[model samples]
Target chain A: MRGAVMYAPGDVRVEEREDARLVEPTDAVLRLSAACVCGSDLWPYRGIEPVGGATPMGHEYVGVVEQVGGAVKGISPGQFVVGSFFASDNTCEICRSGYQPSCPYSVIMGSIGTQAELVRVPHADGTLVPTPAMPPADMIPGLLAASDVLGTGWFGAVAAEVGPGKAVAVVGDGAVGLLAVLAAKQLGAERIIAMSRHEPRQRLAREFGASDIVTERGNEGVTRVHELTGGFGAHSVVEAVGTQESMMQAIRSARPGGHVGYVGVAHDVSLPGVELFFSHVHLHGGPAPVRRFLPELIDRIWKREIDPGKVFDLELPLDQAAEAYRAMDERRAIKALLTP
Target chain B: MRGAVMYAPGDVRVEEREDARLVEPTDAVLRLSAACVCGSDLWPYRGIEPVGGATPMGHEYVGVVEQVGGAVKGISPGQFVVGSFFASDNTCEICRSGYQPSCPYSVIMGSIGTQAELVRVPHADGTLVPTPAMPPADMIPGLLAASDVLGTGWFGAVAAEVGPGKAVAVVGDGAVGLLAVLAAKQLGAERIIAMSRHEPRQRLAREFGASDIVTERGNEGVTRVHELTGGFGAHSVVEAVGTQESMMQAIRSARPGGHVGYVGVAHDVSLPGVELFFSHVHLHGGPAPVRRFLPELIDRIWKREIDPGKVFDLELPLDQAAEAYRAMDERRAIKALLTP
Candidate 1:
């Protein structure tokens, strides 16, 4: 089997590796059909974070079950499935409450790494959401998107309570932020404000149902949102960049008693308690519990109701894993899908 | 008219001042029936906040309208009313969206000082909620409570989403915290845990429907809450204190995907962005839009269903305003009520 591994910053290589096998009774072997590079992957690729010995890469994937352990009841071989970044028992109290990311028995599938020809999925029965049948080739990208970005964006919109009659502002123009515009529209938000300086990303935002666009950055962008909202700011703001500037912009763009749903992987950002206290904005975010939305997202993709895959501006063969990482890290591609 | 004025830290004087008169078309002059010292008043009294000359003291009040401006249609002379610390127009978009504390034409009623025989309330139509044909003599305490602490506590409960089947943890044991226990009960929370060390406050919490009490402070209190909830934090946490420890404890006491509603007047508290980002807890707080809850609260009090005023442990004549402030500041009383 071949997998994506990083030896150091800005260094990605596809190397032959031992094939994954069922080491636990609840684990199942999966042959990945599709995988992708994530925005968070750039943190280490750009040398912003520490990278030591060879580290397995990628956490998002959709695949076909090849072999299953006896304990896996509902999921079986030949089934098409989508799984989240973290594997959970789903029977735990936290999973029952729909917080699979913090599941007590959770395991980071990233350690096993999805960007490979074969991988072991732990707690298969609970971690994987099986599609009704084999999806068409055209549905691959959209389903793969649901494995992480789309589902995370949906959670961000839901956390911010974006729904009918809401004026929603998004602070990021990445794959997740673009998908969030689609989710907010699906949830019935009347006004969608997308903040993006990139022409291509802004065009996609418009296609995804953004009612307005603001190219200004930081506090100026917040002021523009207030101007559009009659000086009261939007009802909900989504923070997707995870930087201090982006978070503050999202917070400031919301009206008093509004909600700020931040889905960005917080890196070096810090928030002053006094500012948050006086902002009067509800703050909710973290590593999104994408498993919670996997079922519904797969249904939507299978029906061709939404084309979240449009976020993948570039695609590559699994062997070209290094090029895919470069394209995303250099901002040449919004997202890159790899066919394994 | 005589009012309490703070010349500096630890310097409070009862001095004669000019009587308040109608300043705006929506203004109403009220002969105060009662006023009391509040926890927030200590901000400037203790010199944590700067004070210039003799600053007006007190904001919580229930009073009889002595005069009304021509445009004040909803309230008239001789009407007894209960209003919050801020006077809001209630017609602005923010107010319409239920954040009346940030109303476009809002004014801080505290600046005029309620600890006087007569005070002017602006935006009378939107600011004052007239009592049902004048509350009974004994109900004065209850109505005064509704003016600030009771209404704020209710907002905290609502923000925390306290309801049946949920475990609620309260982070403060002051008048507002005690009242939050009452609000949680009214909202049907199944279990109420009050964090307090004071014997009298703990007793008051029990009387206010606290099903359990934790005497520990900070992290220990959070641990106790987790122990009470089977090692998972409470579903809802109400933060009634504005210190960093209390804020962090409230956030830590809630389960992943839980809600924390904070209402303490923040002085210098700050939250680490990374910690909050990973907590996966929903945070909402600020100066509560108390006007939004005034009608329902007044109705409940008028019907003799809730006696929130039990929090007032000290009663003093209006002339002894200094004593009222001393009782609350010295922690000798949970809250104080003054009669003119």
Candidate 2:
């Protein structure tokens, strides 16, 4: 099987790997149909995050179940499925309460990576949401979107309580933040503000439902949000950039009693206490419990109710995985979809 | 009129002052029946919080409405009233959204000093909760409790979602924490754990409804809470102290998806981003919008359903305001009430 691996920072390659097989009672072997580069992957690629030797790369994918362990229930081989970056036993107390990311017996599938010909997923019964059936080729990107980005963006919107008559702000211009703008609009937010300095990203943000755009950074960005919100700030703020500046910007852009849903994969981030105390904004966000929204997202995608797949402006053959990483690393592509 | 003033740290004195009069259309002059010392007062008294010379003190009070401004409606002269430390119009969007403390037109009564014999209350129509006639002399303490501590404790319980079948943990041993114990019990919490090291406070906590007491601090305290909750921590945690240790304890003591309602006036508080992000607890707190709880609290106090005023362990004549401050500052009293 061919899989993408990062030997070190800025070093991505497509190479032959051993076949994947179910290793646990709740495991399932998947034949990857589609996989994509994620914003978080840029961390190590840009030397911002430590990368060990030859680590499996990618965590977002839609695939067909090739094999299932005996203990797996509610899923079987030949089924098309979308799974979150983390495999979770949905029956755990935490998972039952709708926080699957923190599931008691969860495993990070991102480490093993989904950018491959075949991948093994644990907790199959809880993590995989089967599509109604195999869909047309164009639906693949949207279905893959459901595996991570779309669900994550939706979680950010819900976490921020973005809905009817509410004002929402998106703090990142990446694919996830652009999708968050779509999500806030779908959730009925009256005003959706996107913070982006790039013309291409800003154009996509507007297409996705952003009513306003603030190209300013830091304090100036916050000031723009306040000015747009009658000096009270937005009713909800979505944080998709995992940086100290983005976090503060998200918090500062919300009104008192408003909610901040931050889905960014925090890296070397430290929030000062006094600032948050006075901000008086409700803080709730972490690695999103993406599995919690996979089922609904898959349904919406299959029905063509949302076109989140538009985020993937670059596509590559599975064998050209290195180019996919390079394109995303250099910001030439918002997201790069790989066909296996 | 006479009022309590702080010339410097540990220098509270009783001094003659000009009588309070209605200064705005919505203001009302109140003849204070009672005022009390607060834990927050000690911040400036002990110089933990800087203060200028002869600053007026006291924000908690139960009093008689001696005069009403032209715009004041519903509330009449001679009505028994209870109000929070911060006066809010309670009609603005922020107030209507239940964030009265941050109301656009909020006025801090602490600035004017309710410790005076006569006090002017702005936004009187919306700030004062009129009691039924004269509350019995014995009920004065309970009514006084509703002025700030009790209302704040109730807000904390509500913020933490302390209700039937839930486990609650309190992170302070002050009057507000003890009252939170009572509020949790009233709200139907099945288990109330009070974190206290002081013998007297522990006894009072138990009396107020704490089913367990953890004398531990920080990680140890969280471990004790986990041990009590079958290793999952409490469903709700009330933070009555605003220090980093207390905040972290409250956050750590709650299970994922649990809520922390913090009512303590934040002082030198700072939160680490990663810790808060991973804790996954729902965080909400600030100077509690005590006005939000006053109506129901007044009813409960009037009916003698709960005697929250028991938190006040000492009483003194208004002229001895200095001694009352000393008792609380020296830790000889949990709270002290001053009568005019």
Candidate 3:
């Protein structure tokens, strides 16, 4: 089976790999139908996040189950399914609390690499949620998105407490931030503000239910958000860019007693305790428990209620994996979907 | 009027001051019945927090209204009242949202020095909550506690979401943290864990409804909390010590999806953003919106339902304000109440 592998910084190659087989009684082998290059992938590809050696790439997938081990139940072969980046035994106490990413026996599916022809998924019954049926070909992109980004954006909005009458501010123009605007809108936020400097991304943001757009970054952006909300900052802020500046902007953009839902993969960010203490905002985020939102997201996608796949502005054949990485790294594409 | 003034670090003097008079149309002059030395006062008295010059001190007070400005309605002369350290116009949007400390027109009562014979309170009607009746002499300590420590503790518990069946861990054994145990118990937390090494404070914590006491501090304390909670941390953590170590300990002691309510006056603390992002804990706090909880807290004290005043272990005449600060700073007393 062919899969993406990175031997070093900026080195992504698609080559033949050993066949995946059942490793545990609860494991299932999935034949990939769709996969994508994640923004987080750039962390290692850009050498910002260290890569030990030829590391397996990708953690997002939507595929058809090809085989299942003896202990795997509920999920069966031939069913199309969406799974989170983290494989969790959904029956654990943490999973029951809707925090599957912190499941006691959770495993990072990225280490196993999902952007391949075949992959072994541990804890199949708990990690994978089947679509109502084999989704139509047109629904594949959105279904694949539910594997990570859509669920992540949904989690961000929920964490931010985006609800009716809330003025929400999203601090990032990436696919997740754009999708957060959609999520906030779906969750009934009265107003949504998307921060983006690019004309194209701003257009998509507006299309995805953004009621306002602010191009400024950092403190200026927070000022604009405050100006938009009558000197009180936004009621809910979704921070999808995990940088020191972005996190601070999100925190500062929220009104006292507001919420800052941050989903960006933070690196080298340290928040001043006194400022955060006086901010009087609720801060909640992490690698989102995508599995917790998969069921509902899949249902919404199946019903054609939301088209999160719009985030994928570029698509590529699985063989063009290197180009996908290059395009996304250079900011030529918001996200690139790959068909295996 | 005589007020406590800090001429220098470790140099506190009770000196005659200009008479207190209404300064704003919404202001009221109050003759302080009781004022106490706070843990935060030690920061400046011990020279940890810088003192600009001869600064007036103290913010916590339970007093009798002596005069009211024209616009100060509802709170009239002769009314016995309890108010927050921060005086807020409760009618503002921020105050209405239950974050009075961040109210646009909020005023720090410390600037007027509550540790005085008489002091002016701004936004009187909004800041002062009248008791059901004049609290009895025995209840004075408890009512005074409500003016700051008890109210701060209640806010911490509420912010941490300490409710039925939750395990709550309090990170400080100061008056506020001890009161938080009582608040958690009153809020129905099934288990309250107080982190304290001092036997007396630990005893007070247990009396305030602490079900367990952990003598360890920092990471070891966090490990202990996790061990107690079956490898998962506490469901709610109240951080009443605003230092880097205490903040991190509080954050590390909460389970994923748990809440950390911190209310200590932060000095030089800073939180690492990456760890916080991945911690998946909800962080909420500030100078507690004590005014928001004043009415209910007062009512509870009126009914003799809580004995928060027990935290004040020393009593002194207002003239001995210097000794009061010295006693608290030297840890000779948990808290010292001053009678003007």
Index of the highest-lDDT prediction = 3
- Rank by DockQ (best first): 3, 1, 2
Q: Evaluate model 3: give its TM-score.
A: 0.99
The better candidate by DockQ, 1 or 2, is 1
Candidate 1, residue A50: lDDT: 84
Stretches of candidate 2 above 4 Å error?
none
- Chain B alone, candidate 2, TM-score of 0.98
Candidate 1 residue B175 Cα shift, in angstroms, is 0.4
Task: Note the residue pairs that clash in candidate 3.
Answer: none
Tens digit of per-residue lDDT, candidate 3, span A78-172: 99888999999999788999999999899999999977888999999999999888888889999888888888999999999999999999999
Instruction: List per-prediction Cα lDDT, in the order shown.
Output: 0.90, 0.90, 0.93
lDDT of prediction 2: 0.90
Reproduced native contacts, each prediction: 0.74, 0.57, 0.87
Compute DockQ for each candidate against the true complex.
0.72, 0.63, 0.87
- Candidate 2 lDDT tens digits, B1-340: 9999999999999999888998998999999888999999999998889998789899999899999999998789989999998899999888898888888899998999988899999999889999978888888988999989999899899989899999999999999999999999999999999999999999999998999999999999999999999788899999998888898899999988789998887777767767777677888777778898898888887788899989989999989999999999888999999998
What would the per-residue lDDT of candidate 2 be over residues A1-340, giving only the tens digit for each residue? Answer: 8999999888888898888988998999999999999998999998898987789988998899999999998999999998999899999788888888777788888888889999999999999999999878899998898888888899899989899999999999998899999899888999999999989889989998999999998999999999999889999999999899999899999998899999888877877666676667888887788898888888887878889999999999988988888998888889999998
- Models sorted by TM-score, best on top: 3, 1, 2
Candidate with best TM-score: 3
Residue B9, candidate 3: alpha-carbon lDDT = 90
